[model samples]
Target: MGFFKQVFKSVFKNIIDLSRPIFTFENNELKFKINSEYYYTFALNNYETKTRHDSYILEAYTINSDNLFVEYVHVDNDVTWNGLASSFFVNLFKEKLPINSMKIIEKKEFEHYEFITYKINDEFTLNFIYIYEINKDNFIIEKNAELYINLLQSFQKDYKYKFDKNQDLEFDINISIVKENALNGYFNLSN
Candidate 1:
């Protein structure tokens, strides 16, 4: 349960608005929350990857209260949603690629879809996921993102960017939120 809870928190932190609608997966069924806009989704199938990276494929759907949209997604390699959106797939190599660089080897484009391939340079790798769309010629990001700092601890542990042991990893992204949205929606963790 803690694992799922972490996943939920990670998903939530990536979004800026808590008031908008959110959904989560449960017992193979999609549940929706109007106020908190929470959604829980677990990988139903392993996503296939061609690049030599420590990446995981996540396939989940946005469960809707209305039956107007597709209810089930078999295997979605990239993130998907029905709204004004934006996303990018970033590759993080275990060993910083000799000054950090990525090269796209392939790109497939269709009427309403696009997929790009990148050549990773190091051992351990992470696929930073972000996907977005343009609506009415005005592009707005439907999702906010927080990089997983835990994955970089081995690299930044003694290096020290800022903060202390007490600060949440999110502080790496936005330190101020540590006081406003403490783990429980308030500054209670310090106590």
Candidate 2:
């Protein structure tokens, strides 16, 4: 009976493993494996900032020659912060983070939130994103045709990523949570 139980557990674990995606990084290349198939992918850390006790990071990546752009940002090593992305600054010359390095593919928005998923096909898909605080004039404008990726950081475990190889073909940005917030948030309300 014990032998039968062990076999059952092993089979169950194997089944679970088969359904999961395997990510491999070797020879400076990123490969994603799903269901026995492998895909070649390229990722870039784009931009990052660190200042003793204040900083933020910006990142973007695509897969297998696709024009998808997945971005994630961290403020003081915390995975959070989004403001209203307005089109008013579309033609502004001031380049700000994130939006400057994207090509508009699809965009979605809420009252105080705006999500833009871009595709870098050519110059036509190029667009701008201007983020500003709610009901405030303080704005961060970004838009550049040639925002190259420079410094890179290893992937942290606190991100949300979805990689699929099925026929449906869905692409999305992965948002990972930081190991911990800086000083646990000014008011001590976070971990």
Candidate 3:
């Protein structure tokens, strides 16, 4: 009975592994290709910030070689400041995608959060933009202004995204602080 159980477990593990997508990174480009018609690539450029932090900017391009599909920028900061602002923007941009599937493709210790890329369709790919914040005495304050520009002549003007019922896609910027022993306060921009 024990021998049979071990055999079954090995077979199950192989099946699960075969169902996952394959990712590859070579020559400074990270790529995932499902077929000729479906794929995404990130062209990464890294530089040093004036403050001496390592920074990178990634441009996500589509299969047909549309260069300006989307852009993501990140600055390597301590873990405490890394993901706070990016999470908010990620939640906002995710609402714009059809989001067939999403997974974390890469994560680094010096990076703020896991690098997540979403598969919107065969031709569209999106990634998150990460910025940092400082927390002191269990309190943190952040201020940001975002300006979006459309550079494509073929951009859709009437496209709309339908979100899942359980998905919260609302964008209400606010301040939230969490301490080890207590909750600070939430300041909602809407109110």
Candidate 4:
């Protein structure tokens, strides 16, 4: 009877584990935190290339269908992040993208945080910021208070861009952030 009870408990535990979500999001001050069972998988799935080492993993993915790329780094040390970000910007200067206009509008570095803003075009802008010495446990916070504001103008527009057939054709379009990491790096789509 004891053996049967043990087996049942094991089966129940496995069932619960299988139902867990892959990724969860929590809002920070002005940014967001992405937590996942397989953070590496989540990073690799979105990026075109990856640089892995014992201390850190750096992955870069392109947005706007390969028109623009951003490199994100996951490291325990602050120095590693600073080095990677510097190298990335240096490379950007050497090899300019095919975009019509690209320029760095602002760059700032503080004791605990650093950020760079790039103006891609007249309509879009890209901002990258890193904060150090942050509390990893307090991942979520909420505060609501409205200040006096004025509405200048508001409008909504929709546009679609077509991609070439050979470029990223095998990518999964309906990938769920919560489900992808649960697969344990076994991506079904063929590349």
Candidate 5:
């Protein structure tokens, strides 16, 4: 019975390992480690200060890749700073990222939270970073597009991205989350 149990566990572990993405590169290049954490509010109704923290870990490979795979390790780093949540999110634009380094692909709002997609280049290393906040209820999509276009123009002037004048810019970003109730769902029995 114990041998059977061990075999089952091994098979489960193998399955989980296979489910995770694998990384491989052909060129020898320096990889940059990206780490960022942000805590904001979701309760825009009552206007009370509430916060949730999110942390991301990103590994970059040489040569351009289509998507960025980041791991979420810590959640809710904003709980303690609840009293200042509103002001914190409102004053976010003070942060600015260097232009021409990355492209702004898309900005999305989910459940009253806003997220922006930025293009990543394998050649340009991380220099500066930006953190922008948006009010999902009031943030106009057209404004986001304007912001992206402006940023792209700056990038062209600043870095002169190596591309033909007619080439279209492209990149990918993804978001992953573990819900509050399913913190340990991976170990839970599924039906």
Candidate 6:
């Protein structure tokens, strides 16, 4: 009976999310809390790169895709939540600057959300991350990527210009498909 219970528990855990909501929408604003465990797990794995830059895969995939831990993620890291976010900005900015001068300008981790600012160049203030986190019995989900993409898609909010990451990306037409659904009740997005 114990064995059966363990198997069922494992199966059910994957089927249903018995934790905080991964994506939340309300009011005229949308917020996201990236999953720390998923970020750590993805960082823990190893992979082969198609470029010489150590962070090529990590930066490119995370930027190209709408989510960070998408199927294209094929990189590794040894930093915590803040550290990885830090690296993501560093590698991102370094792409254009290519200057070996990256430093932490500021770091603020609140009870729910956190921000890590990096000074990779003269205009470092532009390259910062004010993101949220999701914790499920200490388990992490891939909400950060979702928020990043959604923020840029639904909100037209992005920092690609600051780092010159996608400076050449020209959206000739307004093909952005956004679904504006009214949230039913008050959702205390205090995770």
Tell me each candidate's TM-score: 0.22, 0.26, 0.25, 0.27, 0.19, 0.29
What would the per-residue lDDT of candidate 3 be over residues 1-191, giving only the tens digit for each residue? Answer: 99999999988877765543334334655444333344345553441111111112111111111221222222223223333444444443344434444544322222222233333443333333232222111111111111001101012235232221212222232211221102212111122
User: What is the per-residue lDDT of model 2 for residues 1-191, given as tens digits with 9 covering 90 to 100?
Assistant: 99999999999888876654343334534343323333435443433322222234332222222323322222333433332224323322123223334455545333323434344333223322222222221112122211111101122224222212123333232221221225323112124
Residue 132 C-alpha lDDT in model 3:
26
List where candidate 3 sits over 4 angstroms from the true fold: 1-84, 111-115, 121-125, 135-191
Instruction: Go through the candidates in order and give the clash count of each.
Output: 18, 8, 0, 0, 4, 1
The lDDT ranking, best first, is: 6, 2, 4, 3, 5, 1
lDDT score at residue 9, model 1, on the 0-100 scale: 90
Model 1 stretches astray by more than 4 angstroms: 1-43, 46-99, 122-191
Question: RMSD in angstroms, candidate 5?
Answer: 17.6
- What value of lDDT does candidate 6 attain over all alpha carbons? 0.31
lDDT, residue 18, model 4: 52
Q: What's model 1's lDDT at 82?
A: 30
Q: What lDDT would each prediction earn against the true structure?
A: 0.27, 0.31, 0.29, 0.30, 0.28, 0.31
Off by over 4 Å in 4: 1-84, 87-97, 121-123, 131-191
Regarding TM-score, does 3 or 4 come out ahead? 4
Please name the candidate that would achieve the greatest TM-score relative to the true structure: 6
Kindly indicate the candidate among 1 and 2 with the higher TM-score: 2
TM-score quality measure for candidate 1 = 0.22
Top lDDT: which candidate number? 6
Clashing pairs in 5: 53-76, 53-77, 100-155, 103-119
